[model samples]
Target: MSSSTEPLPKLFTPLTAGDIALANRIIMAPLTRNRATHGSDAPNALNVEYYRQRATAGLIISEGTQISQQGQGYIWTPGIYSPAQIEGWKGVTEAVHAEGGKIVAQIWHVGRVSHVSLQPDNRAPVAPSAIVAPTKTYLESGFTAVSQPRELAAEELPGIVADYARAAENARKAGFDGVEIHGANGYLIDQFLKDGTNQREDAYGGSIENRVRFPLAVVDAVANAIGKGRVGIRISPVSPANGISDTDPQAVFGHFVEKLGRRGLAFLHVVEGATGGPRDIAPFDYAALRRAFKGVYIANNGFDRESAIEAVESGRADAVAFGKAFIANPDLVARLERNAPLNALQAETLYGGDARGYTDYPFLTEKAA
Candidate 1:
């Protein structure tokens, strides 16, 4: 997203994608604020208030909520699996809706990008292969070494897909307008898509076809459980964040993107760079993927207001998602609309805190009041 001098740029235009409609083109990219109930991993009042404050975004994709106990990676992030969790999220979706906003739950599973301490019963985190990511996972104590994970048994794949489907249904029951499968940022789905993480010789690995098998299966299951038109997916084609690398991201993601388009998803959010990092670390044909997808393509990562406007106007993206920019400026869309100065984000309080950096960011009206 880029900053601009002109007001009412292309970024503010309304758009419709499948069953979901946006009042503007600035989607709030899901940011893991780590403010959930720690022990239960449930969405709480803080999470509700945080999202409600940002309801002006065209669409608010909630922070990546784990789909199961095994899916958790870090402390204090919410889950959608348990009955209590579903009830918890009901408050959040209701709050957002009360403010006249649309929101989708970003269902996630961290795969090998986790530590034993984060897993149930201190079990090893599961992944496509037993590869240990050179990544660290945040624990209540602090960031700790990510342990090597157990390779998911071939028979266990279907259960994971089932979990996703159930989670999608749970999301709807929790009052979310839809669900966005967390297929990006080197999570479970990304682990299977990229060759570096998936080394299995079985039907779920080896060739690109085999590698993408489980991920696509998960998508189909989720789509069937929830209407395809209300489902979305997020992917990082060339990003090597979280110790993930692909031998050929272009070919791998090109194939994946084309297959995903065939599912008639609501939208496809593509992270063009390492998650929350630089864009030029690798060369990728984002345009090609956009052309291949044939649906609403949301370009994310490293975008300012002006660049976001350019992307929507130039037809490079149907919308642009803003992440960190939304942390401090809950009224981000309003500020962008008025071209107003922004409040600085409190970096120290970003991950875990009270309403200080979460919901206390004053709206423009609040400042005047």
Candidate 2:
């Protein structure tokens, strides 16, 4: 849109985010495709091919991988707990690395965003409080309402933190470039962070500092297990995904990010407005968040090539993450480079499906032919 005198966008430049070195500024965001091995809940050959096809991305953040059985909220989503699961991921990492791409495991715990059927021993889900999320979880049958979660005891807190630490250790064993703690999207960390969901008088509830305790504990444990440079966390202060809300997102998240900066983590991935929704869904100062985090700032949500370029060249974001765009375009980086048209996304096949929408999207070369 500019004159020929204007400089090219830096979206394709190479840079390093903590320990992980990227080939470009265009990143592949973590997407949940329920295609893992059915019973084992581990990454399989299909996932390996899927990731390998998109290895041209600057960095690939793997789908939300549950840290434990209790962390799982959806079926067929991969986990990083068991030895078999770790072995399954090793193949994925090796394939990505072979293609000169960097990948990080998104260690996750869905917290109260799960149903009873998905829990261990068919028990109720756990959360900071006993509130039921006004959301649904996809099961083998269909999408159903989330179950009522019981309040987790103080003693159980350390075990959950341990699970996060163990997941990071397992990610290292699985040959991942690093691990991204899934602390966003109204999950466990977000549930505890927002006062709308958490209503307790304990040390983990009430004020902003008290609410951030559990999340910080998990971050510290994970960073201890892996180096700080190998760790990053995702946060969505104003996002209302999965029925999450905060009375004061600014004050709570400001304090949270300030504390995170002191830890010297790799990057801070922030979902600007709402998860997969409007960017102006709420009144938020994303620039303030960028200022708070001293490390890399990866901006996500509704970004096109031009905006992505502007974000990087203007220093608003160190990098930009593409979610649905990457799903339909394996060679997304190349397509963007040439200003080529993108493939149409098959929305129906986005979830639990075979290679039709997963890896069957044609490349630019294939389309040209």
My TM-score estimates for the predictions, one after another, are 0.97, 0.98
Residue 61 error, candidate 1, Å: 0.5
Provide the global lDDT of candidate 2 against the true structure.
0.94
Candidate 1 lDDT over residue span 1-369, tens digit each = 334654567789898877988899899999998889868888888888888899999999999999998999988999999998999999999999999899999999999988888888999999999999998988888878898899999999899999999999999999999999999999999999998999999999999999989999999999999999999999998888898989999999899989988889999999998888898879999998888886789999999877987899899999999998999899999888777888888898888768887888888898989
Sequence-dependent TM-score of model 2: 0.98
Off by over 4 Å in 2: 1-8
Whole-model alpha-carbon lDDT for candidate 1: 0.91
RMSD of each: 2.3, 1.6
Error of 1 at 364 (Å): 2.1
Q: How many clashes in each structure?
A: 8, 0
lDDT of each: 0.91, 0.94
Residue 152 displacement (Å), model 2: 0.6
Q: Give the alpha carbon lDDT tens digit for every residue of 245-362 in model 2.
A: 9999999999999999999999999999999999999999888888889899999999999899889989999999999999999999999988889999999997797888998999
